[model samples]
Target: MSGTAQATTAATGTGGLARTWSSFHRAITTNLAILPTIASIVIFVAMIVFGEIAYGRIVQVSTLSNLLINNAHLIVLAVGLTFVILTGGIDLSVGSIVAISSLIGVKLAQAGWPPALAILAMVLIGSVFGLISGILIQRFDVQPFIATLATMFLGRGLASLLSTQPERLPEESGVLWFATKWKVIDGPKVNDLIVTPGLLLAIVVVLIALFVLHRTRTGRTVYAIGGSEGSARLMGLPVDRTKLYVYIVSGTLAGVAAVIYTARLGTAQNITGIGWELDAIAATVIGGTLLTGGFGYVLGSVIGALVLGLMTVLITRDGSIPPEMTTIITGGILLVFVLLQRAVTRARH
Candidate 1:
């Protein structure tokens, strides 16, 4: 009787220990999953603190305002990217698509097209490009990378055929108003807060993206696809249609970004968006979206774009770091985040 009691006690203790360990492990992985996003927030706040200490006027209303203005287009691009990345797909044609849209919008406006009509055309062009990419990827067996790359080439080629040189929008065109500044807060000593319609558009995009990603069934399917396309198919989700939707969203927003950028600069060139696709990808990765897909936040991408914008402001203020160093810094930051993502993925598995 004593031996049996002792055996039973030993088994109960072992079982309790195993359960405790399992619970602890679950807790750790769950926290780890959220760590990248929290890290991005912390890093952004840290940069602000460092900037304020190291550079005067870093937090001034004017400087802060300019940060958003300068990166408004990038924020839009990153949000679009978040959608595709969340579906475990990529769109390398975004930069090229921007070039095509900007060129078309400007040409139409110059040719006496109504601003609203021209803007609609620009958006439609983006959607067409996105639709092409989606069809190639879904209807056919083309890999996302190859399909987007081919579409990227097609966009650039079409833009080149339109005009190899820069086309300037007329100053009197109604489209230019998107870049017109509106004072928000009249601050002390020329530090007033100002914003543009372009910035407002970007904010609206972010809000919409938030709603779609968190509130809709399509959004859930997007995540499911990213988590595992095979499993998503097995579960009877609308995998094909959802994948198409994400690409279309990405392309359409790329058009919107072109509108924002071209209006601000008053010039559209075939080369206008060269290398911009890489920048958007960097922003997305730095924002805590996994390059492998399935985990990310649109708001996080907003913060990530702001981080890059702030870095640019600091570099300019310092007057020591070359403007080109911005890309190098971006590359470094992207790499760090990618490694962190790998660690998280391992833990999750």
Candidate 2:
């Protein structure tokens, strides 16, 4: 072949390879929203390796159980946020809802109400707040961020106004009983590896979230809206109602998180969920949810929470590391994941 023809052929071949690689990358990233969950497992493995090298017994069943128990609330909160993100919206008020719900639920139970009633009341309060945000954004043309931010303040103020101090729920309260472990597996060593009802609740919520996002028509509509609100609307996809429902679902989940947290702690406080919103957002994002809106996975959020929880455990196990270091590490991971998301998004263009 002539030199010019050879050069052209080489360029064409290179272009084909580049295009293939780009397609593969996009496919993997989009479907691998579940990758974060796997990454969390890998991180745990790495932590175990590091712990074995640094501090023996870091992999003990007691340590793992404690880690899971402590972070169950985070997992639940993350799952709720994932639903909101998948619908191409944000819910900044979940932490506040958590606090408010915790306060109301505990107070009602203390005031001679049945535990079920208190739980219902708490979830109702959360749903109401969510509805307000949804209405403001979907009907009034307000931004989702601004609407949810307003609700965040509203929830926090309500929680604080409800009580300036922590209210301790009685240990004997049936609500607290939900926090106890049921000993499903009964491991031979180190506390039996029992599973707390709170953890099980979180798992159940994750499964439900997965079902809604993947199987339901409403869920598909959510993704369509997120993919393009204008197109969804033009196509008559019930955009406004779908957006409203997304926020409501998020709010209800937040309330459920409050019940889990309150049951586990046996205490409800105005300041109970300070900064928890950031953690939930981070978990959702790190789990591969797009911040620009649309695309997410419940299992990914669970993994993100687990990754964070494991990081905390690792830091605590290492005597040389300060507890505050965990926050810095988490922030770093979130930043990296966000940048990765942006890169993937740009590549699709």
Candidate 3:
């Protein structure tokens, strides 16, 4: 009887220890996935609270919806950027691509082409540009930064050549309907939940991006390439093709962003997305994408974009905070995140 009791006690102790270890492991996993998002959420809440205190009704649903609608294009841009960064690559030409596509689409619309055709042309052009960058980087062993930077200048010049002045989108274009507001019933009759098609589209893209990254073999290859290119090549993982695909994806998304922007602003210019590449990169970094590549999350990028959009709104709402402070704060956050990523990488080594 004594022996049996001892044996039972030992088993129970071992089981308890195992359970505790499992719990700890889960906690660590959860933290790794959520730390970046948590930071964005915390900042978002802080911004909302500050906005409420600084500007009356700034925390209202209408105000929040407006902010999201205004920045939906940036959200898409950031998502595309997140994909490129995940593969240890950068796309410097996306902003210029956006400008070019927007200008081209608007010009085509002005020339009496159907809105659908113009939109398709814009997206295709963007993908073509991305393909060029990918080919250059993969075929020539060019650094991603330098290759994309060259494309950036080319895209910017193309956009400028297309039009010397801002082109207004046709008021009659059906595509503009995407910017139309929809009211989801909330509580009382007039206090409805407001939503924009642009917001819905952004959400959908983020969801699809997450699914692709986490569920597909091609996506896994991207992570693998980012983690170790030499190993990926030895494994016969289609490294060059995969890298090219990522750029194409980024460019295609940028073109879509141009359509969204045209619908929102009803105007396009060569300078429309002049500095947007920086914004997208900043968003990706803030969302926990390692600058050196390999690990990243699309949803994190979405949250990062939201965090930035909210910061802009908050700064605008709070007259006391200088507009320039927004850039400084974004830069600071990026620096901190990069440092943290470096530390984590070094610790692993």
Candidate 4:
């Protein structure tokens, strides 16, 4: 009943209320931070359900298996882009890297070179180009966009100089083994669960990327850089090395994608992978990887790639939706996700 006692009780009550509100606010913001990623997942599930109901065979084992087999290269590319994007950098050269790598890979095979040697050369070439880009950005103070753009042109030009026409792998080429398919389940009436070695390779790449981005110290360092390169440097997180590593990973994976793609088609052309860079970037963004960097998942990127593939599949099955409309639809979806990202970011702030 005393005045001082009453005042003290009221002050304590106010402090408790403030603390509760602060905790509540934190919880909401944290949820909002991951909302975009969650939205992507929901959208993907919704698409599958809608497709299956509207178009027969959408959920068939065969269709699903083929989806993975066909887009395996894109999945790998997305994984690589995830790494680079996580570090708040862009790699414009991945598509061109695919063009050049596949060109060399198929040509080498056609030349009667050992498959192992050709494959090794293909991967190493990517890493080399990645290193060049990293050096230009980190050491020479070039912007990532400009540096990567230059490398992109360089890669495409090199491929064009080598061959303008399509290159085909000989039937006896050992690299064809990558395209070999294995049936994991014998479903009835062409519904068997089929998987190709290329798909397996893509799965391996995803696994390795997940490990590197989540389990290792380097992974933590990558997140730190994306969060803030200045802070990462202040914390002694090897920002320079990690930036280089991400680009190298992206380039190397592009090469791997080329291998998978070339094996699948047994052919490569100078124009191969045209516009694929946009697809990879769109997949990453749709997967909820912040364009500004700092938060994303490799698995999310995989799902994003699948969603894009499924869109194309649906278009083909529906026959009413023009095939060319696929890009317009994809662009619209990407715009929505990007806006979603912006909204989530604003909510966090």
Q: Residue by residue across 189-276, what tens digits does model 1's lDDT show?
A: 8999999999999999999999999999999999999999999999999999999999999999999999999889999999878888
Task: Compute the lDDT for candidate 3.
Answer: 0.85
On a 0 to 1 TM-score scale, where does candidate 3 land against the true structure?
0.89
**lDDT by residue (tens digit), candidate 4, 21-130:** 99988876777757777788998899989999998788789999999999999999999999999888999999999999989988888888999999888888888888
List TM-scores for all candidates, in order: 0.91, 0.87, 0.89, 0.92
What lDDT would each prediction earn against the true structure? 0.91, 0.83, 0.85, 0.91
Better of 3 and 4 by lDDT: 4
- Which pairs of residues collide in model 3? none
The local lDDT score (0 to 100) that residue 150 gets in candidate 2 is: 98
Q: In candidate 4, how many Å is residue 55 off?
A: 1.0
Collision pairs in model 1: none
Q: On residues 46-66, what C-alpha lDDT tens digit does candidate 2 reach at each position?
A: 877887678787666766777
Model 4 scores a TM of: 0.92
Which of 1 and 2 is ahead in lDDT? Answer: 1
Task: Judging by lDDT, tell me the better candidate of 2 and 4.
Answer: 4
Error of 1 at 143 (Å): 0.7
